[model samples]
Target: MYIFRLAFIEAQLTDAFIQFKNHYGFEVQVCNPRKGNEKGSVENKVGYIRYNFFTTSPVMNSYEDFTETLRVQLEKDRQRLHYEKEVLIEDLWNEEKKYLLELPVEDYPVFKEIEAKVNKYNEAKLDNTLIHIPKASNYPFIYFIVTWDKYKAVSPDGEILFEDFRPYMNKKRAIPWISIFKDWIRKPRAVSYSRYKKYLPGRINEYLLVEDLVVRKERLIEIVNLLVTHDIKRINEDFYDLITGNNENPFGLDWNEYDALAPTGGEQS
Candidate 1:
């Protein structure tokens, strides 16, 4: 069942009523007149009824007697002139009943509580951040989960931030970049040997001479690309085997020969 709080404006209320009727087969039930849009006509009538019928009447002797007196006065005012309409309000309401729609089987949707867990990182990981919070923490530890592209973590005080949703389940896990790099280099591709020279310490580059320029420049890019993608743990092993004669290759030239070649004209500085 869906529930909506009505707006105060007459046009807005009318439009909302129409939408509610069309979408959920429900009619507006005016229970608390003060809470709903009390039109000028209704307001004036209320004032008139209170002034003429209740204020002028004699004070009651007891609280119960006063309640009964007010009820009688209320009925008497309903029979009196109803301000703008110039007719009894009860009669007008009876005629207006035909325009009201039937109520729906279910109530309108209302606001409800949402549960979200906080992670050890003090962030809400939700489902995408490669972290998981414990099921037990799903209740007490949960404050709220916010919806972005997916659910994100929120603080107990309703503050939303990325850091609050840290992964609670896998606290000590580390991603191995070196192992990732080694796997990437095994694929077939053109190689360049010079790409890593710039990345090497400044001391290492200073020691490299003109004789080592060609081998360092050629096919180094392909090798670097391989190293970057493969797992870091296996990078040195892969680099050594590729450069030394230990591994057979179609390109029979050794690393020294490769480095001695002149730089390709279009190669980057």
Candidate 2:
């Protein structure tokens, strides 16, 4: 029997888990409530993971790095001899893997697809985050396939519009500012009213909020250029640092009078 813990969700089994079970033709046996003894081996494995792998907090730089660390840890654990068999766990896994069913040709759909309307701002909200929909000026709506770490926006005709990495697991909102560059350039003043304007560096906001429209336009152009020329992920971290007072400008710029007050179309001295 394929034993599993009782889930608190209405379906008890997750949609993905159910799909996997159906594909493999497995009969699930859920343990009785509060009966830890029935799932003693699973509980023991959990305890082992908690004590051995999670005893201390890890420095997780990124999801990929954290997953790599976990994979390495599992490999290290498998190097040990099995408790009952007195053989290396890795060798046992080699035999066990051979008996497992071959994976299907097509991968199971683990992501949820949702239809969303592009708002007047040419953006679509997914999981509370605003994702930019390029060429959405005419397209009224798009479909977003949401996964654990990323999501893809597809047109009605199955053509991919755009895709972006989910910022985090939590419900915080984010903007893919780069994707909306053209719109922002057309309406540079709208940056003041953007949802993510609060995330901008104070120095940047101050520079862009100047009374001079020319200076503001120049600053907006510069901001777009900085985002376009550099790694967006690094720029995002720099923005965080600027927010926390750890850095001055996300772009590492010390804007002088020439940069801030320069004429729109004149040559630099």
Candidate 3:
């Protein structure tokens, strides 16, 4: 049977139509406008149908779906109406059907596929942008598949994350300690001395200058790193041994007392 189709030129429907023509070997007519009267017949029929049927339909949902349903209903109208030639519309359709084109088995316009990962923060990491998933609790993880254009991110459960693309790596997590130390070093001695005065013991306050604050902070960082890597018990024992000057008795003295009293536990009591 003859089938009529309408689509926008920007949509590139011509290629699809041509593929149908090549496969079916039928007499295909493309109703595209070059200048005038190109779409006049289509436009007039569209308006007439809309005004006659669509305006009267009480249960129409969407304009597009309503128009499609109207087209099908018009076929029934054509069958009932008597033409000047006394030929039925269904009879006309039967004659036209023989010369109509057939569609291909294979679907056209292949789509591109891309890979993406979800990070610990539950944000979809696509390319560079971190996309936040709405109602994220429904999904098992933060990962998503991004379309080729990176316009959309589909979560594990097929929920779409709209136009939110950003850098994949987390800058805050990777803060440069060297740069931070350099900035601290450039600050005024008085500012540093005032900031760390609480860490120094009452007697050691007079001995610690601004330079000592930097040294103490660096040592604390090292000690903390070791404590985290090894064990708290080992660190406390080592600190006590360093402070008490008795290598054999590891936990002989208080760790906090050593931290407060001595700049470096090497200083003699």
Candidate 4:
């Protein structure tokens, strides 16, 4: 009875957060911002974790890679003896495992609902970024199910029309070259006029600016295709290697297949 009284102490919580706790059948003691010391063990462990895990300044390729590395590190950390219990931390967890409840049978739904207007570009503006929605001209507005990492466009009948990764993920400061490449490839001459042209290496930009229209178009197509998988530096090195006789075809393409992409400079007689 005394334990129950202590567990039910009033604390601030959002409706969704409360729902999350209920779904997992777990108790969460809410800690106010200034009173974070109420969870002193957790707070201290954060500092300990930073000193141990981040002191080396680890680099990760992506968000998923970081999570996987952290999971492995955490499991390894669990093998150590508990500071006060004088037993393996894993053993302590094993001893308490039986008291833990199983996770809920159904997955918890997590998303923020927001109404998005279908724009003239057949895309919806989400978080002030545009995401293409197929056949969006048929509808004036869409309701997006927004999560931290992705968004989903749902129809009036709940049919999913589009699903896309958020623009900001892993690209907070990087240019979205892949997003613009498709449209730009169709108009090769417009490469110099593109906003992203300035982001390209000066040499590549200069090469594309040469007076020979057909040569510029061929080079632009090669760059756009190679850019899909390789970075600008690699593209530059490969192009230079090819021109220097070190590589037979650094673009890895059969020019015969791209005949139409580069016309015969003038109409065939």
Could you tally the backbone clashes for each prediction?
50, 0, 4, 0
The alpha-carbon root-mean-square deviation between model 4 and the true structure, to one decimal in Å, is 11.0
Candidate 1 C-alpha lDDT tens digits along 1-269: 99999877543366546765777765464545555455666887788667876676666564557779878777765786767779887898778988887667776443223465554322233445533322323334554343321233344555543333123233333332222223223321211242333333222222233244344344343345544655322433344454343557534544443332232221111
How would you encode candidate 4's per-residue C-alpha lDDT over 66-96 as one tens digit per residue? 9899999999999999999899999999889
Output the TM-score of candidate 1: 0.23
The TM-score, computed over Cα atoms with residue i paired to residue i, of candidate 2 is 0.57
Tell me the spans in candidate 4 whose CA falls farther than 4 Å from its real position.
Answer: 1-13, 31-33, 156-158, 168-257, 260-269
Off by over 4 Å in 2: 1-18, 22-37, 104-106, 115-118, 135-142, 155-159, 169-181, 185-188, 192-269
Count clashing pairs, candidate 1: 50
Candidate 4: worst-modelled 10 consecutive residues by lDDT: 260-269
Name the top TM-score candidate.
2
Residue 113 local lDDT, model 4: 85
Candidate 2 on 1-269: residue-level lDDT in tens? 89899757543888779888888776798876778899999889989988988878987877788899899889888998999999999999999999778877776667889999888678888877666677765678889888887788888888887876764743343445665545666777777787655555444555567666666666566666767655344544354443334555554544442133222210111
Better of 3 and 4 by lDDT: 4
What are the lDDT scores of the predictions, listed in order?
0.43, 0.68, 0.46, 0.67
Clashing pairs for predicted structure model 3, backbone only = 128-166, 128-167, 129-165, 129-166
Q: Residue-wise lDDT of candidate 3 within 190-262, one digit each (tens)?
A: 4243423343333233222325666545544444354344343344445444333436543332345434443
